[model samples]
Target: MSRKLISSGSEFERKIGYSRAVVDGDYVFVSGTTGFNYATNSISDDVAEQADQCFVNIAQALEEAGSSIARIVRVTYILPNRDDFQPCWPVLQKWLGEVRPAATVFEARLLDDAMKIEVQVTARI
Candidate 1:
């Protein structure tokens, strides 16, 4: 099996040394992606907005990796505040509820204070 790396054109990937997603054999593993719109380099302060953006980023990475958001097999969410998690449920459900992939949410400090959420996913090609 060959390996392929996907990038979302974020300079952070180059500076931090990471691919937005990696493809190996039958799987695509997306890295922890934040709310920043890679194109605009803008992030919403609202948690729900951030969550919505996370899905967008994930979907793009998955597609580039020959998969789709519908193919996600697992999802991991990182939040700076445990309290912010619930507010994001609607957005999350809208994206992944039907797919029903294995999911988890964690409260941890992110690299940026402005970032409220980071999402990572794994999918099969």
Candidate 2:
């Protein structure tokens, strides 16, 4: 099978040389997605809101790749501050619910100081 690339038209992909997501056979790998609204290219400073938008962005990429959050098998969350984890976790649980995929959360500085969270997902369709 041939590999397929998915782009969400985010300028970062062009600047950073990466696709938003890639599909190979039954699997899809999504790049770390931030909360910036692609239409407005704006990201809020609120940690919980940013976390929710991050998942929403990932869901969109997954959909473009012919998959959904329900199909997600794993996820990795990167947070600049560990204290932000508490606020983000409830939002994540609200979106993912019982369909929780294997996930890991780690602290790391983001590309921008305003970016509170980023999420990367893997799924099979």
Candidate 3:
């Protein structure tokens, strides 16, 4: 089997030594994506907005890997504050309401203080 890398045109991949996503056969694994506006390199502070952006980022990566959100098999959400869960849940539901892949959420400090949420997803192409 062979693996293909997916890039989001971000410099962080070179600095971090990891691609935005990687596809091996029918499986596509996306890295933990933050709510960042690549054009400005800024993260939104609103948990709901951040969650939405995270999903968007994951969706883009999956698309590049020849997959889509409906093909997602699993998802993991890391949040800086547990309290943000309520606001983020609805946003996630809005994007993945029908797909409803296996999901998990954890409360922990992210890479940065402004990063309220980060999401990782696994999908089949």
lDDT of 1 by residue, 24-116 (tens): 999999999998888787999899999999999999999889999999999999999989999999999899889999989899999999999
Q: What is the lDDT of residue 62 in candidate 2?
A: 87
Predicted model with the maximum lDDT: 1
**Candidate 1 TM-score versus the reference:** 0.97
| lDDT per residue (tens digit) for residues 76-100 in model 2 | 9999999999987789888788778
Q: Is candidate 1 or candidate 3 better by lDDT?
A: 1
- Tens digit per residue, CA lDDT, model 3, 8-125: 9878899989999999998999999999987677888798998998888888899888999999999998988889988887898888899999999999999889899899999999
lDDT of each: 0.93, 0.90, 0.90
Best by TM-score: 1
Predicted structure 1: lDDT? 0.93
Model 2 clashing residue pairs (backbone): none
What's the TM-score of each model vs. the native?
0.97, 0.96, 0.95
Q: Lowest summed-lDDT stretch of 10 residues in model 2?
A: 36-45
